[model samples]
Target: MIKKSELNRMADVANDRGVTVWVEFEGRRYGVTPPAATPPLDDTEESDLDRELEAFKAKNGYR
Candidate 1:
């Protein structure tokens, strides 16, 4: 069971790197783009994820 604080920390690191972070919890997968969401512990960010997420947020703003 992962703690919410730990998740928040991981999100912060991913945000700093301008990457997305995906997390699979409770048998569900969640893909979070930096500034809004971060990728899981996949060991690497998806190609163009930063660009893609940022553009999406710019267009729609973070919900």
Candidate 2:
């Protein structure tokens, strides 16, 4: 059993990373998400991600 303090700390960390974290404890489900939704990245950011994905794929021979 996790202490409430510890659980809340974990949720805080997850929320900082723009994620919704979930856990199951004693047959119950727990989840946390940022209070405010994160905005979508602009075109430049999307293009940067696309380039990174392409590089990763090439490096891993996925292409």
Best candidate according to TM-score = 2
**What TM-score, to 2 decimals, does candidate 1 have?**
0.42
Report the number of the highest-lDDT candidate: 2
lDDT of prediction 2: 0.85
**1-63 per-residue lDDT for model 2 (tens digits):** 868897788788887897878888899988877778769889999999999999999999997
| Each model's lDDT | 0.75, 0.85
Clash pairs, candidate 2, are none
Instruction: Report, for all candidates in order, the number of backbone clashes.
Output: 9, 0
Ten contiguous residues minimizing lDDT sum, candidate 1: 36-45
TM-score, candidate number 2? 0.45
Give candidate 2 regions above 4 Å deviation.
Answer: 37-63
